[model samples]
Target chain A: MAQAPVTTRGRGGRAGTWYLFLVPALLLYSLFVVYPLLTGLSYSVFSWKGTVRDAFVGVDNYVGLFTNEAFRSKLLPALGHNLALFAGTMLVQNTMGLAFALAFSRARRGKRALQIIFATPYLVNPLVIGYLWTLLLSPTFGPANTLLRAIGPDELAKPWLGDPSTALPMVILITTWQWVGFPMLLFSAAIGGIPAEYAEAARVDGASSWRVFWHITLPLLRPAIGTITVLSFIGSMNTFALVYALGGSSGGPAGSTDVLGLLFYRAAFASGDINAVGTASALAVFLFTFIFGTTILLNRILRQGEEAM
Target chain B: MTPRRGAVMVPLMLWGYALVAMIPLFVMVLGSLRPTQDLFNDPIGLPNKLYLSNYTRAWTEASFSTYVLNSVVVVTGAVILGAAVSVLAAYPLGRRKFTGRGFFIGYFISGMTLPGHFGVLPLFYLLDGLNLVDSRLGLMLVYAAGSVPFNVFVLSAFFRQLPGELDEAAALDGAGPFATFRHIMLPLVRPAIATVVVFQFVPLWNDFFYPLVLLRDESKLTIPVGLTHFFGRFQNDWGTLFAGLVMTTLPLVILFGIATRQIVAGLTAGMNR
Candidate 1:
């Protein structure tokens, strides 16, 4: 059979018009997003403050970032804190969110009402959530400690945020609280996508609810689970506001709660060392690359696993 | 397998979770209502009286009104301009094939993943070179530009979902491309536009990084920055700080409440697809 020629006359004109339509967004994005990124990368190679002329310095920023005792000291522990946050949210938050979503899905009345209530924390600004938690968890007059003292052992009522031992955990808990709903909603939607026939077949085979959930629902939810993991990983690693608000600019009583984001802010702005700004830029670039690489790796792994199945 | 048992378990669990979710907010309100002294003295006790003065203090002393106005202007300007430009850009990428289209699409989409902090110092220098620092317009530009990739990606998906037959019909009527887009395509994407507006608005309104880095003047502070000042001053005064937090959070809470259905629908649409 002879093939017919596709329409190409207006294609050029149409594409050109498309490019024309894109100009304003492209202009703004290039000016503000692309240019700044390239500049930051280049600036990381030079030594300069706000006013001084830039001088070429090679990989010194990256070297200093990895080697500097102060930087390493803070960076290492912050990595631990970030890891803790990741593990906590992935395990606790995701589990709880899934449970809520499953429950809400089965709920007859007030399903919309409960979903709204659950999702409220996610919509609240992180800064606002941080401050609100600061009040609720405050060591002095906060109700959390008071409630603990009133209902439980008085010795257990230590200043939640003030105690160096508890501060990072409290911050992570609050962080998880604010974000748990997001994954829940995602899971709920994904669950909705699974065919009702699958559940029907499982029940017909005498599978219990737990068995159905474990063997069927969770397996079906793999894509959502994968996505939520990557999203939460990136978000936790890049988290700035919650930690900053809870721990303040110093990042804690002893820099115990310090994360890379707060560390970058402090290094770039707090110390006035100007040299540190280059290192901070290097750190930021490292974080971005790390997240980008991790997400790519995760997608590949998930795709491969999906294909295997 | 009984639907009756399933129904009962679900609501009970939902109500339990809802109460847990609402406790912190309730604490915030109660804490804000208590006197400063009473807050320290009787942390869990009922407020001696509802002290509305804290709101006045938060508004004037913390300069929250300026923050509110600044946030309003920045968010409004960003949404209107950002959405217009993004829709325009997205239409071509989504609808038509062109030379370097892949590269152009990649360029825009990459912005979504690039961390904003990486560009902070350079942006500071860039804005300074353009003499745009410490200005609301500068903040607006940064916010709008930072948000473009996501907006473009979202709107492009939405536009792609729209059938091309409408455009064909308009063209058959002798309407030019621009008129077709203006009169036909634009109205068709109202839901997506509304989604973009809400998505961009919430983040822009609540954002702290740009205003923190670009804006130095207290008068130029947005709500997040202004709340920081209140937080600093009242580091110990839980009542006042909580009051400020409540005031700062109230608008967003009310907005979410009003648009709860839309917000959920929009998020599911954008993220799921």
Candidate 2:
């Protein structure tokens, strides 16, 4: 029934020729990705200062991440920020994305144009998005403030990125602004893929639009929701470039906007300390474990959710 | 909500968000056209005239010419190399049943979760030891290599979905694996290939992180890094900064405009996978 017989014959006869197809990618991926990952793991175990190996420190860097005051101040709060970002993205961004996707799913006129316009932001550079938002949110010269003042919300036009209290939320919003289109696109596709008959049949029974959506559409969209949830969760946890571009390496405004990615970068590159890279490797390992574990768990949960339904 | 209310609200909400998404872009374009003094004075006002000096200033004064060239070269090179390598790898893994196939698939898929930032420092050291630091070629290699996992993942899925009869038929004929891949199987997955191409193009073009870390030479800087430097040097010159920002973004916007359908389909394909 399958290609098992032919594949076995072909495999034994042309093993060398077949593997040649795999060589280029495997070689490059191993050298570029796997090698560096292993090297990072090895580096994490040693104490290095300024690119020089100082001593063999076994899990001391990992342990110190919890015990050390400076590391704790940096890492713990950054972890909190990541959780906050994950929540914001999953709640607000996913909600907004779903709303837009729902809107577009029923849209007839200007559907293509709206999708293009909304998804256009995702096409541009994240660094540029950061700077663009910075300009738009600039305290004195930005258009947002100008419009705010003109609209009689003069006091509401605060420095969006300057105040520590507002900085992380602003970062989260900007990140969402740039990427919300992606989830929307995904959800749009998922919704579009559903047969029209399901909703039509419900409507024929005098189901309200909301009722139809709640009972019929929502269950069908569970897979998409799971995918978006996991993707957004991982994406937010690894948020670095946007934060780097917008909040700077220090994750400024008193590190309120600091996430684990930025903290890892600061530990590796920005800090003038010689032993920081080793510490950074420990952070990387922690992040890898966290991300890998979370992704697997989410995938399992999503599968379970699908199976249960 | 009533069906009437829902129908009216759907388009209204979509159009409203579309306008919101575009306002910053329109503002940037208009601001780029206004003189610095005019932007400072009328931040929200339309440009009175098509002032072209800001663009000229950005093009030459900010070294965007070099940056744009570097960006194009790197993005193009990475897409071509990445697509080729992944197609080659995916053909076997997706179409053929073989020993260690599951292990190999797992190996490639492992990268999807592991953030590139994890091993980037060691990658930096590795590249430096190889004397590839501050080189566009080095940056291109990293981009292409990093793209393999994603490219392979998507392409292999696509390849598997193609009917196996084509491969068997080709095999029944005098066609070898390479010939069959190049002739029959490859053509069947052209859309997937295009999807991979379109998908990788935008991200690689816009990526600032690897270019930031791997590249140090001023001449080799991509648009994002270049624009950041331009921003730092000319923060007060909002006109030129806006112009630089527009220049940095215009290619992508134009690309999106031209290939909106393909881009949308490609994005949806990945998400639904």
Candidate 3:
């Protein structure tokens, strides 16, 4: 890893060619990714509507995003829904994912078929998946209602996506269904990478299965857990297409399924009022800050938890 | 984590979840084969006769044919443009010890963290100003640009794994840097390039956001966007809708079935290692 002397570079003149190689990617990335981000930050301050800048309103847009009643009622609850998604998925999906990983790691029967079948859902488009679930969960003609009725739980066969009380939970479960394989695979890889010797040694010491998992396996899987948490958390926070496809931009079923991404879209595009652009930009900035800050905070907390263990 | 001695519940649980995953897909396929009335009455049952009219209706009346063609074009364009650029960029970053190499690598990896909503409005204006709005080429550009960071990130890592001796040998034989990349280095990293393509292809084909915002023309819509419009019009036709979903998703399902290992490895490549 030692650096070669700078004199080596001066004689070669290959540095120019190296920069040539970097330019295409650098230019494309800056144009689409970096430049737009910086532009969005600046646009959050001004009273602009699409292309026209009206005035330098300073931080008024940010202030309005908080103080405005319409924005508040939608934004705050939408954020809550996102948190609900994160919590629900963590409890159900990750737990299932870990269980599947453990099962696949141990089971001798149908492992490959199970892996392929489990992972298939993650391969399709999220929008398509949302639409498919919308059909499956339809109250009148959907199979879910039929199955529930057949199982003697006729009361359980309600309009899953149409009722405000159930819409968010249904959407959350659908989201979990699409992505459980991701965490399963991630945990499987991490679990697979654990040295067999460590587990063998623990077993030789007469450690019970439950005690071994609690003491050795879970602690060693801290990094994987941390990764899945941060990823699943932020992913839910920024989710758009699933809710948009299933519930529409208004976060339908009377906005029970409302999320920040849909809120941003409704603010920016659905309202048709141009001045809402600045407010939407402000919301975007808030979302960016929240995602970035929480990622850093969660990673730090996970690191500390690892150290404590 | 070791496999514990108590294995019965975990395996049963895994199989149960696997069934949960497969059942919906099974329903989708089965429902697609029935007429609308049959599906309405007997959604969970197998079709009495395989009705093929729903596929034709979805293809012709729903206009998924045009959408599929458009998606194929955009996905092909974006994957090729992105892969070519990534190869060129990853080569220098991975092979040479240039000034600002770390900075360049960091610059590319940073794209992974960007939120989609953050700059979408600004990007809309940017594309509009450039007069690329409502055009396939414009959408392709956005797709290619958006994909560059991850492609460069993955490909550069793959490129770095090549032995330095190969580059030295190529240079010793009077292969210029460009020639070394085009002839010597590119062949060694074909698998990574395929990884980049497979990774990029699914998202691009599945993309609805860019086409929703940028392409206003009906002729230019991708499958996701196109299907939404079709669904809105034929909201009551459950059979046709199911057929449309199957056709739209079948290619990916087939691809995954054929290359499950490659797709999974390509996807989880950076996550673990």
Candidate 4:
């Protein structure tokens, strides 16, 4: 912690230069991100239209969010839908991402080509992904139904986005398609980081590939798995575009896909009822707390594992 | 080592999933080539003959050329400004032993956990107060500000890993702090820079929330919002929508193709350390 010799102008000048370097970022961040965030927390306590001055009602928004029938019915179900989406993504996208990563690790000839192909869906805009899938699942012209009809029975080819029961699941599937590759890349890097020795040692003991993966590779890839899981959980919870595009503002077929984000958008902006903006901000606060807490817990568990190792 | 049968199955499973992943892209291209009636009628089938006019029609109808230009300007501005500020802030945080450095680092990184939309309502009013609503410059500032925390975190970590001997050697050569950073440090962190560029660029290019809230003028809308214009109340024009979707997705696909290697390398580099 000894300071280096004063080779530049002087300590004062160096400190001044440092402050100069920091100014642009600090100023912008303070003006946009930090200030707005603080103001949002303050706004959550008040009711106002764009024209009228806000009146603070201190925790009333939070109280209403919990007690009101409309909020309870709408908000609770939307939270469930968001959780379902997260669970679906964990099972399907993360699982397949891990599988692809393991395979890509061993691929020799077309590794680069295969990586590009697998990553293509992730690079597309979410709006496009939503639209493309909407087309593919359109009851009239969508190829998904056509393929289902061709391969299976006609009974299976229902209007995918139209049916209330199937609509949210369909949106989750499309989002999974677009996002699976991100976890694949993360898992590949993680699986690659596991030193070759552990796997080799397991194999030397007459263990099968599955055993090696279960006993050695899985244990070693814990950090990456934890990181991706936490990140993806937060992401799926914050997700808005796909659901908005596929299910619309109401998040319908009877509000099936009305996740927190879409609900916030509608309540705050779409309705033009500025009083509801406080409620929307309350919801945003709830989401931030939920995800942030979960991430911290996951990180702690991972750190504990690292220490135990 | 014996080539286990399970290892063979792993590749097969991966190949199968890879095929599933590519199905949408293939279908998109196919949809772009077929006429509207044909697209609906034979949604699962290949077109009888490819229609090349879909791209042209999509481009003209959606005003995608203007959207693309707007997107390019916004993304480029975000990357350049974001990277410059992040690097400058990160250098001092990484190299200097100043008091409150940890607190500052933690402060910056905390922004990453908070969703940008959490502050959207207030942000709208703030930008409005500054007369920056619907302006390209406003969007650029927002993007850069949002990206700074993560960029600084990543760059600082990369900077910390550099050998101290190199900094001392540069200092011994009469290189001032600026010169040492310019000559010695910058070259060493090329991989980190590449990672930051790709990471920031992709999200900025694909961003929808800021533009949706901030920009009301249809002429100034970015690609994602512009493409959403195809979906109206009564019905969605499926053919034109798919065509527009394909057009918007193509540049990203191409960009990913070219930078795929660097992306993988850069991402792993950050994760590994």
Model 1 chain B TM at 0.88
How displaced is residue B70 in candidate 4, in Å? 1.8
How does chain B score by TM in each prediction? 0.88, 0.91, 0.92, 0.86
Candidate 4 per-residue lDDT over residues A50-112, each given as its tens digit: 645488889888888889787778888888998999899999889988988887878766777
Q: DockQ for the candidate 2 complex?
A: 0.56
lDDT of 2: 0.86
Winner by lDDT between candidate 3 and candidate 1:
3
Of the pair 3 and 4, which is ahead by lDDT?
3
Which residue pairs overlap in candidate 3's backbone?
none
How large a fraction of the reference contact set does each model reproduce?
Answer: 0.75, 0.71, 0.68, 0.65
TM-scores for all predictions: 0.89, 0.89, 0.92, 0.87
lDDT (0-100) at residue B16 of candidate 1?
A: 87
DockQ of each: 0.56, 0.56, 0.55, 0.49
For model 3 the local lDDT of residue A162 reads: 94
Docking class of 3: medium
Docking class of 2: medium
Tens-digit lDDT track of model 3 for A1-309: 322432254237766878888788788878877898899988889997555888999999999988989779888999999999999999988998897897788788888788878977887788888889999989999998889989976898889899998888888788888988889988998999998788789889998777877888888999999999999988888788888889887889889999988888788877776777799889899888888898999999999999997
Please report how far candidate 2 places residue B31 from its true position, in Å.
1.2
DockQ-derived CAPRI band for the predicted complex in model 1:
medium
Candidate with better lDDT, 2 vs 4? 2
Show pairs that collide, candidate 2: A49-A274, A50-A274
